[model samples]
Target: MSEVFERYERQYCELSANLSKKCTAAGALDGEQKKQKISEVKAGIDEAESLIRKMDLEARSLQPNVKAVLLVKLREYKSDLNNLKTEVKRLSSGGNYLSARDDLLESGMADTLTASADQRSRLMTTTETLNQSGNRIKESKRTMLETEELGVSILQDLHQQRQSLLHANNTLHGVDDNVGKSKKILTSISRRMNRNKWIIGSIIAVVIVAIILILYFKLK
Candidate 1:
């Protein structure tokens, strides 16, 4: 039983780390970091699964009596927990803790199995409760691991969006620079065209004046 607990704890830690890494990777803006986190998550998940298999094996090796006792306790605990949950909900809605606590205690079963119920029954009940609680705790821890993974994924998405925005900004700035260069080239071409028009006009006027001077000299 103690070994089982130890195994469960080890797996819990591994699972948590894996989930965190996954979330981090998913949200990572950097490709390299995202890749690394993915690897870490994979390794962690594998390790946790291996630990779970070992725990299952240990559980199966226990005596039938122990298993039966555990089942009975689990059923009882579930019933009690469910009732407590309902009462808690009701109390919460009305903002009344005092009444809720009273209801919980009244519904709860506290060490009710006396010594007369046979040693086998007692042992089974105790072992079953311990094992079931342990399993439930482990499951809850794994749930947290999943939550962490989701968080990492969200972060990675944000990172990617930031990168994309930066790229777009750079592209827009480049376009602006190109447009400015094109405008300067167009202005220079316009100025050259104006200078050429003045030169052509002067040449035409001189030709016309020469023809008129020649005709007048011949007549004289």
Candidate 2:
């Protein structure tokens, strides 16, 4: 379960890094660092969601008490995910509209510029929505951190429960060690399948050639 959390944390950090990279690449020098920080927080939400899913899957075969904690966390994470989605849509729509507005301004269309401004004004009404979305995203990140803390508590509970029940499960029991070997085998299979594609074409070509030769001989 902690493994799941760790994976999510890494992914969250990566997402924040990616978002920061995007801001920097766009020449947002003054605010790039700030944007990156916000992105990091937003990424934390993602990390929490991933961990919740992993926990849910892992908890399915566990005891009732273990399942209950995981289920609660999963539900909380899902609720947060939904809210984050709404915020994302709000921000993305505003960002897209602004981008379009910039394009319109750059196009140098005297008639369209007035119309574009009108459209931009309409987008402005959604300003609160954008701000609210940002707040919600931030809130979700905080919630995710709370969820992670809860997970630690639940994991400790699970450990205690296991001790009482004498659950003799190894963490590595479900892990597939031959993943790389499996990938290699899949690649080999794919290559063999692709070879058959050309073989069919060659067979068709040979058949056509044979038919022509037979026809030519019969005509002669």
TM-score of each: 0.44, 0.27
**Model 2 TM-score?**
0.27
Query: Across residues 100-203, which tens digit of lDDT does each residue of candidate 1 receive?
Result: 33433454522221121233244345556766888898899999999999999999999999999999999999999999999999999999999999999999
lDDT of 1 at 94: 37
For 1-220, candidate 2 gives per-residue lDDT tens digits of: 3334334433433443344334223322224553554465466556646655675676665778867865664564454445444433333332433343343344443244354334334433433455567679889999999999999999999999988655434434433546667888999999999999899989999999999999999999
lDDT of each: 0.55, 0.53
Candidate 2 pairs with clashing backbones: none
Q: Give the best candidate by TM-score.
A: 1
Error of 2 at 7 (Å): 8.0
Please give the lDDT score for candidate 2. 0.53
Kindly report which residue stretches of model 2 are placed more than 4 angstroms away from their true locations once superposed.
Answer: 1-49, 95-220
Name every residue pair that clashes in candidate 1. Answer: 23-152, 24-152, 26-156, 27-155, 27-156, 28-156, 69-124, 69-125, 70-128
